[model samples]
Target: MAVVKISERGSFRKEYIRWWKHPEKDIQLFDWLDENERERKTLFSPGYLRDRRNPLPYGLTKMECGLRAAAALFAGDPQRGQDYAANPRRFSMSVHDHIRSLRFKYRRFNSKIGAKVSNMAYVDIQGPLLQKIDQLMLVECPEWIRLHFHWRTDPYYNQYWPKDQPTAREKPVQANAPERQLRKSSPGLVNQKRALQASAVRVRDGQNKANSPVMELPTPRENSNSGTTQVRSSSTTQEIETLASEGGHASVIHGGATNLDGSITSIQRLELLIQLRKLDIEREDKKYAAELQRAQVEAANRHQSEKHEIMKQLADYVTGGKGSTGGSSTGRDE
Candidate 1:
């Protein structure tokens, strides 16, 4: 499982999902889900696990960028964001409704919905919508958003608020959640975090070393009188070059390369995220399988017990009949 550690900046980070990614929306929604799940314990069940609704294995298909943007946009709407934070399922269902309406509207007038908008303004909404969403989240929300956000449904987020903070929502988003709990309760998770921490630290350090600007060695100078200059090969420079070559980062650092440290951080986070998501999916699948198996076993036992009871009743009926007949026959013969 991916471990969440307090970063150098002290914000919770999970893969590409940063706590400060989409403030007033993404972070809040993530927390809402966590708290809701914790309180209601309404996570994946055997039935849901078997069904296709919101399949367990997330990121199997990356969400279309357009939809992702639209969702972000929808959430960034101060009113909508608060509503969604209050009720995720209801908000999602509303999206479903809007999608249906749009599908009907577009399908009636245009055959090429992707290229043309029929009666609408834009040709392809994929980019524009995303831009608007980005603008709403990255720029407008912090300025214009109303602080009186409240949920009509459940206030799971508000329960942990402090007495002094005059905010609708409470709690500095839980840095460590279930995975955190697992670390405390399960030795395996603790060991796993340690191993992953060590590995990421190594990659981070290696990238920093690889990306460290190559120190400018002194350029060979021409002797004014002799018109010749001898270049002394520095063993230190040779060793550095050798190390770079051995590390396979020699060419990577040249030409003002992109932040190798940032890239490594992304890679490390992504790798761990994939592992954690897959593990979570695997665990859910296993849980469903176990529950299903248990149900089947219970069913089989109940059926066997019923069959035994029925057989015993039939045997008793037969034995009683035989006894009665024998007694009558003996009486008649006597």
Candidate 2:
């Protein structure tokens, strides 16, 4: 394993205190601090780290760390960051640790200049970081900074601000919400909802009406307003609506009696169908009767013709007509 090149400020401070306590004038302090102990500090950790890939160590270089951070921020989603961190093939946790360690190192390094170890030098790393942030296209920089963060006032941010959006604007008032509330609270809408609920209830009750015994309802007397009906069922509502829409107050209650009338209509239709079938049957029977009478007449005529033919043959034999044996004998005597 590569030996760690960095350490926490406390350890560096301890080493600095040790070096201070010792007196070997020939031993160089540069060699003591650098070759012996390299100095660094950052916001994320006051602890030490080993050989890493940050440019300022900061990353494989500033570019790689910036790329990773940019992708995390630009996607604006937690899952995107998770996916990047979870992938080992393309990522190095050591590299992430390096950037994390050096991200705000400049401020700490500046603090260290007048303190115990003045050897830990400052490096301006935020410029490259800001460049990466711009490349990632975040509208604004992240806001959480307890240390020195001068990048927000940088020239690039100032130039980019007015070029894309010139001025800060007032929050626009929402005008449509009150209208929506008014529509929802409208009297007509409430009545329509109630009517629909009633229709649904009627339909559900109608489904099992056969099992429920029907109670006797008062007979509905015919009124001049009989074109309309009060809502006994969904069908009755439709009838009332039709009458009311036509500019009439005509109202009536369709009772159970209407059901009998409907059945009677159906029975009448069946009777008509039966009468049509009977007419066809009677016509067929008459045709058969005509054919039978014609056949009987033809048989009678055929029998009479055969009887006449037999009688003529007997008469011819008795009278001794020509070609008979008596007729030939008489001719010979003549």
Candidate 3:
């Protein structure tokens, strides 16, 4: 530690003694007094601090005492400032204490001088002071001096310390191991075997219905007995057959018909022949009607033309007879 003998006549110690007597004389003095009162209240209060030991030395103001106490805590000895540089914490704390004591005392003496010293003090002590205090408490501290004093015994220190309690990786039991195994299996294997068997039975029943002889009927024959060829009564197959026969007759009337699937049924093929014959008869009837109308119109026009020709011939014949008789009478008169 470097032995820095701060004399009673030094600027810092002198200003501190002066302000201690008259606290309200300067604004800085008043501020230090209020800060000292608050700090004392905190240290003496029941809920604030567990230990009530005064950390400051005797014969010093609160600010000066606090600086000296910090130096003594980190320094080699409180009586002599020696062997301080050997320990980084001690050296840092001593420097911080000297600077802070000087700053407060200077503020009490001269405001302008205090401001300049404070700026320089921030540059030198701010980073080192925080680092040293944080190491002492084994936690992080704030950068600002006011905050450092405000929360001197940090509650966040124990909270941020690495806890000894176990984490999730340390636990043995897993909550979702069974669910994870279920997800890894195929969906087909996951479903019950009984359900798959029931589905297969239903599909087989459908194929049997499609291939059964009861659903397929024999083709119609021209020479076969019509009674035997007719569908059996009291059967769903019979009803379908009757509907098919009716559809055949509709196709005969309309010339063509189709089933729901757009394919021509057996009934539609039989009806198509009948429809072609009906269409031929209808075409002959239309041709006869048209020919009759044309003949009627031609006969009426020929009759009118003949009547006009007969009237012109009668007028010419009568004029010729009259001219011939007049010429013969003129010859007899001559």
lDDT of 1: 0.34
Candidate 2, 1-334: lDDT as tens digits = 1111234675441111111111111022111221211121111222323433444422243334334433433234343344444443233333344334333443233232211111110112123332322222111111112112221222121222223432211122232342233223222323333433443455457755333211111122445443442332335334433433443321221111113334211112222222333344556768989999999999999999998998998988777654687777888999
- Which of the two candidates, 1 or 2, achieves a greater lDDT against the reference? 1
Alpha-carbon local distance difference test for all models: 0.34, 0.31, 0.34
List model 1 lDDT by residue over 174-216, tens digit each. Answer: 3224224322332232443454555446555766534322111
Query: Which segments of candidate 1 are over 4 A away from where they belong?
Result: 1-264
Off by over 4 Å in 3: 1-261
Residue 307, candidate 3: alpha-carbon lDDT: 89
RMSD of 1: 26.6
Q: Which ten residues in a row have the lowest lDDT in candidate 1?
A: 144-153
Arranged by TM-score with the best first, the candidates are 1, 3, 2
Please provide TM-scores, in order, for all candidate models, with all chains considered together.
Answer: 0.26, 0.20, 0.21
| Candidate 1 C-alpha error for residue 271, in Å | 2.0
User: Which stretch of 10 consecutive residues in model 3 shows the poorest summed lDDT?
Assistant: 247-256
* TM-score of decoy 3: 0.21
